[model samples]
Target: MNSDWLAGGRAELAAERILDAVRTVFIDHGVSGVGMTEVAEAAGCSRATLYRYFENRQALYVAFAGRETRALIERIWRDREVSVDRSPAQQLLDQLTAVLAEVRKTPHLAVWFEPANAGIVAQLANSPGVVDALAANFVARFRPGLSAPAAGRVGRWVVRAVVSLLTLPGSNEDEERAMLRTFVLPFVLDEHTVID
Candidate 1:
């Protein structure tokens, strides 16, 4: 029951509350339109308190993106219904496709994919520690022989491709899947990896 521990717990809760407010605001106002003042108002906290939790709008957005990315990764792994016998390439395709579907299904996360907000989302997506970790982890799990740097590169590429598709979707899901198989798999998977 230390005072410092209590303060720390309160701070963490406040930060989470602020993020929840951000989710609401982002969905209502769009990621590009929301600012610190708006977030503070939505969170029922002063601008100073909001700043103490998140230094700037970009910082808050990055934090939100990081949180969503982790959730998306967990959901993908959890909901995976593919058989163990599937090839690594096939599994990766399913995983990436699920990622796109999940983002589209989540309103706050989907807003970032809108043309106006996509640049910001892309910036965060390409950042080293954000979605890259999730992507690299997925790749490493499916293709365990890949080196860390190589897996990381594939991870970044997967993020970039997902962002691209989100920004400018293909004719349909069928076309998108075909594109991933033809363009993405060849580069992401090992040369020896078969895609049956």
Candidate 2:
């Protein structure tokens, strides 16, 4: 019951509240439609308190996106572990399935898929740390011996294709995964025809 400890605890609580509010707002309104006032109302705190934690809407958006992306990477890593008995093809297929499932479940991810939110995504695209982290995660999961460039290109294609499928109207995840298996699994297992 020290006064300073109470003050710090209150501050931490407020920050968490604001972050949760921002996340909800982003999910409901996407990036362009959300504002500080709405975030403040969502957090049940004044605009001043919101500003204390986040400098501006863009900053909050970036922070929220970063948190969501980190969470996704963490979940994928947690759910997947390469085993000695599993073939590289099997590992890649498993990783793809898990990642697609995670993306479907994560709310904020829909914003990035929106055409109007392209600018926000472009900002993240330029971040070297994010790129490196993504590459490392892919390399670790697929354990592919391909050159970095080749891996990067193929990974991008697979991820985008998977995202396209998940975002489709009334798409069945299980069906899509099965379809992807027919296409992706074959390419990974055989070097005869790379997917063009």
Candidate 3:
């Protein structure tokens, strides 16, 4: 039993080490440019060993993105500057803008925004786990009265908006802010509200 427990611990450690290697490779080469062989080489493991942890590049991408997304959410929550007293619309805008700025500044996370990898990132963002995290953060922190389903819907819209901005950025930050305020704020705050 002790030996089995040790083996499981070792396996978990190995998987985490592999993910660390994946982060380095993602930073060095954009997420789309990386492959199983590159990950294996970076991890100092045989291809077969790497495969034991991640079945394919897509699986690896999903895992990495999930990890990064969780970290980003935690960072957003940890930010002392994010005042809770702000209006729902203002809070959502602040959070969305903060997420965009953080992802752009973090090289490992930023690689996913490259045009080649945007589709993959968008697909991953739609996964239930990611959507739930976004919903929980938005509901519990920003809008306490929002229903779970409502939060999920709003969260997905916010994510789509963020992904769009990341993929095809506006002319400048001012323009981007204007676009979010004009297009996203109303819909996110009130589902029935339509923007003209």
TM-score, per-candidate, Cα-based: 0.88, 0.62, 0.83
lDDT of 2 by residue, 99-151 (tens): 66676667767666677766666665554444444644474355355566665
Tens-digit lDDT string for candidate 3 (1-196): 1223225557767777788899999889888788898988888777888888788877777777777777887788679356658777777677778888898899998888888987788888776675566555565455556767666676777777888898888888888888999997766666454322
In candidate 3, how many clashes are counted? 0
Question: Compared with the true structure, what per-residue lDDT tens digits does model 1 show for residues 1-196?
Answer: 1224225557768888888889999999999899998998888888888888889877888888888789888988999966879987888789888888888888988898888986787778766687777788877786777878878888788778888998898898899999999988787776575322
What are the runs in model 2 whose C-alpha is more than 4 Å off? Answer: 1-8, 128-135, 140-196
lDDT of each: 0.82, 0.65, 0.76
Report the C-alpha displacement of residue 40, candidate 2, in angstroms: 2.0
TM-score attained by model 1: 0.88
Off by over 4 Å in 1: 1-9, 191-196
Which pairs of residues collide in candidate 2?
A: none
Clashing pairs in 1: none
Ranking by lDDT: 1, 3, 2
